[model samples]
Target: MDTSQHSMHNLFEQLGLPSSEHDVEQFIRTHRLFSQDIRLDKATFWTESQAEFLREAFEEDSDWCEVVDELDSRLRS
Candidate 1:
């Protein structure tokens, strides 16, 4: 097996986060959302869509929970 095939996904698994298409993409999005209403410790530049996504994720705070829960459920299955 290619050990690095899903390195990003695996890292996310370690953090209990789902793999994003690109870390930079998520990085950019997360801070942009943060910038909308708050000055973040880490600054970023992302499009409005990115900001929307990060805002949604922050509001729901469920993507990671679901990913972890899904992994557990899969293990059970």
Candidate 2:
């Protein structure tokens, strides 16, 4: 299992955001977990494509899964 953190560019790209460190940080700060136990995949902030990417990454347990899980937990918290 590759436990290393992926690049911010990859994460941002997958999320359909600009691939920049500042943007990534700003995005994380701006978006919080929705109330009512909503999943990250259901977050309103994401575009349809971004949401689908997250859902697929999680369901498929792909290489991006760990990062997706991390993002999910962080946003929820």
Candidate 3:
């Protein structure tokens, strides 16, 4: 049983990205999803492993889902 809470910072860390608030904001600002049709895991900026993690998180509705979804939304906007 895994019972850990995750935030955007944590999600970035898991994805091997910079985990600071400023870094996350900078990433989101630069990586805006140009098309609504593009899935978060399919975004070109993500490395294969990062994409897989996001895919699995959403597919499993795991503990990481909320923050992953939040990141998805942020990148789109």
Candidate 4:
């Protein structure tokens, strides 16, 4: 079982993004989800693989879900 701590920084790394705190904040700030109807995984800015990872993370309710949900919340703001 994977025991590594899951956080926004780690989640960004999992998504193959820059995992720094500032980078995550900048990404969320610039990429607000304009429509409530659009899911995080369906956002156009993500590459296909990133989208798939997000989709699966939520669908499986895996360890990554909380962090992913956090990201979703931030983007929605």
Best model per lDDT:
4
Residues 1-77, candidate 4: write the lDDT tens digits. Answer: 99776999999998999989899999999899979999999999999999999999999999999999999999997
Better of 2 and 4 by lDDT: 4
Instruction: Name the better of 2 and 3 by TM-score.
Output: 3
Q: lDDT values of the candidates?
A: 0.41, 0.79, 0.91, 0.93
lDDT of 2 by residue, 1-61 (tens): 7776676578888666787878777777888776847878888888899889889988998
Cα lDDT, model 3, residue 39? 91
In candidate 1, what are the lDDT values of residues 1-77, reduced to their tens digit?
43343333653545445466576246335433322344221224434554444455445753443443333233233
Cα error, residue 70 of model 3, in Å, equals: 0.3
Q: How do all models score by TM-score? A: 0.30, 0.79, 0.95, 0.95
Q: Output the worst ten-in-a-row residue range by lDDT, candidate 4.
A: 3-12
Model 3 TM-score, all chains together: 0.95
Greater lDDT among 1 and 4 belongs to 4
Tens-place lDDT per residue, model 3, 1-77, is 86988889888899999999999999999999979999999988889999999999999999999989898888887
CA deviation > 4 Å runs, candidate 1: 1-44, 64-77
Off by over 4 Å in 2: 1-5, 34-36
**Cα lDDT, model 4, residue 3:** 75
Error of 2 at 3 (Å): 11
